[model samples]
Target: MKRLRLAAPLAAAVVALLPGTAQADVTYPDPQPITGQEIIHDPTVIRLKNGGYVSYSTGGVIGARTSKDRVHWDDAGNAFAEPPEWWYEYNDTGDPWAPDISYRDGRYWLYYAVSSWGTNHSAIGVATSRTGLPGTWTDQGKVFTSETTDTWNAIDPAVIRADGRLWMAFGSYWTGIRMVELNPRTGKAAEDATVHHLATRPDAPYAVEGPEIVKHGRYYYLFASYDACCSGVNSTYKIKVGRSTDIEGPYVDSTGKPLLEGGGDLVLEGHGRYIGTGGQSVFEDRGKDWLAYHYYDAEDDGTPKLGLNRLHWTKTGWPEVF
Candidate 1:
């Protein structure tokens, strides 16, 4: 098994000491500013068993944050618990991006990717926590690598456990979205497995990426961010979706069109001053699904920041955000 070494016990102990200093109450997905400084991108929030929320994101030395209210946040700071020793071996300049959290088997598991924009040399790393908070994390290191320097870019990983099987959806740029099965116990890709391409657009210069899968009403819905992102005020990103009866999909949009044929129902796009909104993670709180994403804060001179909106499912089973 390939592994990446994270920092030692010092960092983890420091983070563990944090939750003792403050306490807040968890609430619904309210529209509140969680991070007051730096650009927060690729936000993934999970509800811990202890009744708090933990959020992880991209591009900073800090890997996770803790919040009692899901609005007010405190930086747990660098839960990688180790230096870049392992990640540096893979790509020295790449930053850890878009961490997805899942609680299973009496632990909190974080699956994340490391890569720079437009590069295929990306790898997915994992860390586990006995307690879902910051300090208890045990970095299990690299579980899989794209290693596909020529054909496809592998980044933006999201894992979903459905029908007693663990499935991973990931890809970007070169060949679009792809899925493969993983060994549930180890959270590693199955050996000799083939990746199935779920979405692609060879004709469009802009690509489909950031694959996020969620099961709703006997259908597996794959939500992907389309086109370019991270251009600040000039971004061109949009949210699109396709659904299929099977977890491994031939996902189709509402018109009975396959996603491979460029069929997607547009969910959210830039409005007025807000430019290029996409890269979404949907979460259900109190029976209502909320869309969590980052967009340029148009009012603040177009500063890129995280935003939240309540997701409404239409009568036809499509999703929309108000």
Candidate 2:
């Protein structure tokens, strides 16, 4: 039960007094306390066409949860009743991480990864479903992969349609984040596509992963997690972002420092009982933009759980969650 502890009455009163469009320097509030089926990591959410919200996460067979009101979630099932037959060939664990869910052309596309830790030997795969419900997906096979010789780890798959073409951004703790073009028709890596290097931390530890990209207004914003993760309450994970006028970025932070040189604007960080707030996904739902991610609950001895917060755009075009 390591949920966020906000004074409900005080929070309500604060909201009641707030004016439209909070100040650009406003601090992000803690996530609303949610109950039931909370264990999740690397979560990505989608608003169903019928209005119910569903989230997919990293877990055995890809974790799935649903919510009717976006505040109370219930475990639905795993996206796969059984791991896809090819998963074992990449990693014997039969688990997938950091699923990116998107809908296009009347179908739902889910991209995920299978790999062991501390290695570049990994693969990104895709599945499509007419209905995004659990067990309905048809495995679309490998979109891309990397070997030990490569400088990048091919995991943490995130897809977006930019400039009328499907593109994917992925990588972790090696050469930083990288991007590639996808076959618009198949949602797989496009033939003859070139990989484009995106952001990286040139400093020690160089820990960056869980990239989610969104195009807002005239800029493409790259959101990524920084620092160490998976260490329970000791994890130092936090979310950071940068923006570029073009999808293929020379992304820069609020100070105008380039992300290629380790610059990023802080978005959210742990405070009080919430720790390691990272692994995020952004989407527009019910007329409001939302950020969905997982945070380690310090009160629960560092168990990870799903967290959601409304996102707002600043006057200068930066995105903030409060």
Candidate 3:
């Protein structure tokens, strides 16, 4: 299925709103250029032990791209050259969506989503590696599936540790963001679950998805991508954020509005030069926070490519693009 597309005029309007906005301290690659293939989307950049970066993203096959300077990337080929047999057994046709890589408990875990476009029958699967690189990954099998077709559509898996417990926050389309505790040692959901409705907009052309969480100071912030994300040059994808003192929360925006009520502080939008700047994930490097996402390069013949910018937190504790 073709991905959802956004209206051109509306996308342009959102881009005009950005500029001179709050920014965080960050250093961009001297000359920014498209680093990987055009199909790369929902990228997760993880700093390796050897002081380099490895990225994973959505595609039919799990693939890897490496960067020495975090600017230029070299495709390391498919991490899983073939789709896991189990995924094929469950669903005859398989297309892997976003994959988030994390290292914990002496293992490198890759949590990924599998589904066909525009469908809610999605599942989040897991793979592991000892070296956290391509060719070394081993599929550990599916971790969670969307049990309730009426409520939440599970995809875009992000795992975080809070208050001595491991938790995962994931959802898309059907409702909003939902979280469940995980047994960190097993990388599986815990029995005691606490789910939160992070964001929803029933009146908009699109709904909330792509929940990427980070803890700063005394608050846990949830950053999500909203609107249509795959319309090529017509995409309206933008980044939004809400925060709370607790992990599973009634996260609120700067205006003191709960995320479930369509409240979010805008972080990145199409700025006329770049269209649909969302599907973001935060990477903290060298004591600074960097926003990694994909956007259509307006100047580069309008192709979707990976982009990175630094995130600045305002004195009042609000985050914006740098």
Candidate 4:
């Protein structure tokens, strides 16, 4: 989910650059049929070492669920049995949201946000788990933070590893997406790391957040949620993308417009029952890439549900979802 109401509807703005499957006509495909424990928001899913799958999302203590074949799921439990003491510093309830899970250095790293609604006083924290399962995480502590004085909000954290360096991309309506380097050993912000701006709307209260970076071919693709979220059926949340040859970018849409100037290629948008398709992450399994996100189900009266789609790449390296 995102903070602050959006200033305007996202540009109808740009069309996806798909060629074959999602080619022509702007057809937004429905999510793959999934059942059981499907309601979730801002989901971060990992294929466990046991060959099963576990997903953690925003809710009570970072709500969790599991699956055996990636179709049927079961409620597992919360990732944390209790909130860490420091979490209260950011928010009264110590509620955490928009978690990112990844495997690095032979262990799993979990990053999540703690903050109250509509405020930039936020913190992104880290926890580790050997098995990456619910109730098995060890709270490592806070990694980064932001306050009312900070231009960027430190929420919706997504991390990507490159060249032995850990980089976290985070932000919200305050100033769009931002990236900072993390200490490899500690998984915390580097002592003097500079926060680099990645994407934003040209105006104030820019509605871009939930940054996910994936290295494909020679470029790094930045995926982010644009417009409003958490409003049920009325939500205008959509997914957009930009790319850069360098990790610390200068990312731009297909037309070569810089993301810093509000440029991004429309990737996924609301269509049919799948409305507000955003809060996404990308993970590769069995040599193929997959996109995981949440959508407001129109048929279900705008209930948020898990959405999974196999990602296809164009010959030029941009991503496509059908």
Every model's TM-score: 0.84, 0.91, 0.85, 0.92
Once fitted onto the true fold, the runs of candidate 1 whose alpha carbons sit more than 4 angstroms away are: 1-38, 148-150, 204-206
What do the candidate models score in CA lDDT, each in turn?
A: 0.71, 0.84, 0.74, 0.87
Residue by residue across 1-322, what tens digits does model 3's lDDT show? 0011111221111122236764332212211344555446888878888788888887648767888878778878877878887676335666688888888888889998887666677778888998899889888777777754447776899998899988888888787778777777778764445565667775643378888999888889999998888887888888888899988788888778888888887776675567887777888888888778888877776676777766666666766554
Please report the candidate that would top TM-score against the real structure. 4
Better of 1 and 3 by lDDT: 3
Task: Write the number of the candidate with greater TM-score, choosing between 1 and 2.
Answer: 2
Which model is ahead, 1 or 4, in terms of TM-score?
A: 4
Residue pairs in clash, model 4: none
Flag regions of model 3 displaced more than 4 Å.
1-39, 89-91, 190-194, 204-206, 299-301
- Scored by lDDT, model 1 comes in at 0.71
Q: Count of backbone clashes for each model?
A: 3, 0, 3, 0
The 10-residue segment with the lowest total lDDT in model 2? 1-10
Worst 10 residues of 1 by lDDT: 1-10
Per-residue lDDT tens digits for candidate 1, residues 5-120, read 11122221011223666432211222334654435677777777778877777756436767777677677775565545577755675468777777888888888887765667
Supply candidate 2's per-residue lDDT for 102: 93
lDDT tens string, model 2, 196-265? 9888998755688989899889999999998888999998998899999999998888878888899898
